[model samples]
Target chain A: MQTKIQELRKERKITQSELADAVNVTRQTIISLENGRYNASLILAHKIAQFFGVTIEDIFIFNEEEENL
Target chain B: MRGLFCGTTARNNEEYRKVVKRRMLTMTILIIVGIATAVTAYMAFHHSTSAISDHTLGIYSGVGFGMAASGLFFLIRDFLLLRNEAKLKQQRLEQTDERLAQIRDLALKPALFTMLFILFTSCLIGSIFYPVLIYILLITVWAFLIVYIIATRYYSRKM
Candidate 1:
């Protein structure tokens, strides 16, 4: 899964730390999500989406091939 | 609203503080018990009339000292967490982080298997020289397996 978290955060002039604080997660988690190294749980995804004032699909791009792998 | 989010975070922080305070109390109790045990072990070791063996006294002393040290370590950590607001917030975030929790869960199985392998090898080596040591190691291995089995069953039902 890839996420537009970095782009969205940048567009909103939000730092990773700020986003992490808003979502109640470590900065490392935001970094990992932006880097596509980690997939956020549903709860975290919801939090992030709410923080960004967007839908989950607007930020996270889920690929069927990735799921198959 | 931002106010609602802040309220929730404040509530969570309060909950974490309560949890830490409870742990500190438990640690205090542990320290007292440890000190009492150590004193008893010391008196038993020094008194000729005591019925307990020296080896048992030594074990008690070690356990008591270990418990005290562990308790002190955690107590100090909790104290620091309570004193430092930034550190407390960071620790709380890290503790509640889903990604870190997942990583911990993923690491646990491999760590357990590695520990079990080390214990099994020790048991095999000790069997050649110290039968009692081998039995103790075997018992530890069995206990670990039993715990794993029981935990699996519990989580399977709960989850």
Candidate 2:
């Protein structure tokens, strides 16, 4: 799973720490999400989406093929 | 400060404060118990009237001192968390972070298996020297399995 969190954050002029604080997570979690090293849980994804004022699909790009593998 | 990002709400702060208070209380109890145990052990050893051996009393003292030290360490940590809101919020975030939770869960199984393996190997080696050690280690292993089974059953029903 890939996320547009970095791009969205940059567009909104928000730092990773700010986004993480808004989402009630550590800054490391946001960093990991942007680096594609970690996949956010549904609750976290919802929180992030709400923080960004966008739908989950708008930020998270889920690849069916990659998921199948 | 009203809308500032503290990673916790009023309800969370209240709950965290309660948790810290509970932990502090437990630590205080542990410290009291530890000191009492250590003092009793010392008195028993010095009096030489108790049926318990000197070696056993020494072990009890050591365990008591260890418990007291650990209790003090955690008590201080909880005290700091209680005193500082920013540190409390950061600690809460670290504790509740999904990624860290996942990593901890992932690491738990391997760590438990490794510990069991080490204990089993030590038991095997110790069996050659002392028969009682084998029973102790075997009992410890059985206790672990029993606890694990109980926890699995509990979560299975709850979840």
Candidate 3:
């Protein structure tokens, strides 16, 4: 999965910790999410979507293989 | 604050070490306090052959018992807290184990851990207690399980 979290964060001029606070997760979680080290839960996806004032679909893009699998 | 990223390096061992160390420290402190209490009690009990005045014996006995009891309580609290923390850590690890697959019991891990820890610890400690504390422990454990079952089920369904 690819997330435009960094792009959105940069556009909003928000720091990782700031985004994490908004999403109610630790800064490490935000960093991991950005680095693609792990995936976020659906609830967390919704949270990020709400924080960014966008839908989850807009932020996350699935690879073809991921989509097929 | 130790490097936030564990880099897939197993953190379970590290966590287990910390908990074991804490329990060891708690047990050591309790033992020291127990020894001091025993020494004081012995001194007071045998200071003289003269039937040890009820007043003096009573005072020393109360002091010794109080110290020992408080020490025991601290040990028990530390054990309980460590047990709770370990359970949470394990559940969180399990929840975050794999993103490739969804697990049905993911949401239930934390509640299961809390209830099981409380129940097991209570039962274990109760086996050696005044037996009255057993009732209180059982009540607390049952109430916790009920509240937990309700809250988790509600969230899992609602979400």
lDDT of 2 by residue, B44-156 (tens): 77875655787888899998999899899989988988989999888777766778777777777787899888888988998899888899897998899899999999999
DockQ of candidates 1 onward, in order? 0.77, 0.75, 0.09
TM-scores across all candidates? 0.85, 0.88, 0.36
Better of 2 and 3 by lDDT: 2
lDDT of 1 by residue, A1-69 (tens): 899999998898999999999888889999999999999989899999999899999999999898995
Backbone clashes for every candidate come to: 0, 0, 0
Model 2 Cα RMSD, 1 decimal: 5.2
Per-residue lDDT, model 1, residue B75, is: 97
The model with the greatest DockQ is 1
- How well is each residue in A1-69 modelled by candidate 3, as lDDT tens digits? 778999999999999878865654556677777887668888889989999999999988767897687
Would you list the rank order by lDDT, best first? 2, 1, 3
DockQ of 1: 0.77
lDDT for A61 (candidate 3) = 78
Ranking by DockQ: 1, 2, 3
* RMSD in Å for all candidates: 5.9, 5.2, 13.5
Give per-residue lDDT, candidate 1, residue B147: 92
lDDT of 1 by residue, B53-130 (tens): 878988999899999999999899899899888887877787777777777777777877898788888888888898
After superposition, which runs of candidate 2 have C-alpha atoms over 4 Å from their true positions? B1-11, B48-55
Candidate with the larger TM-score of 1 and 2: 2
Candidate 3's C-alpha runs over 4 A off are: B1-159
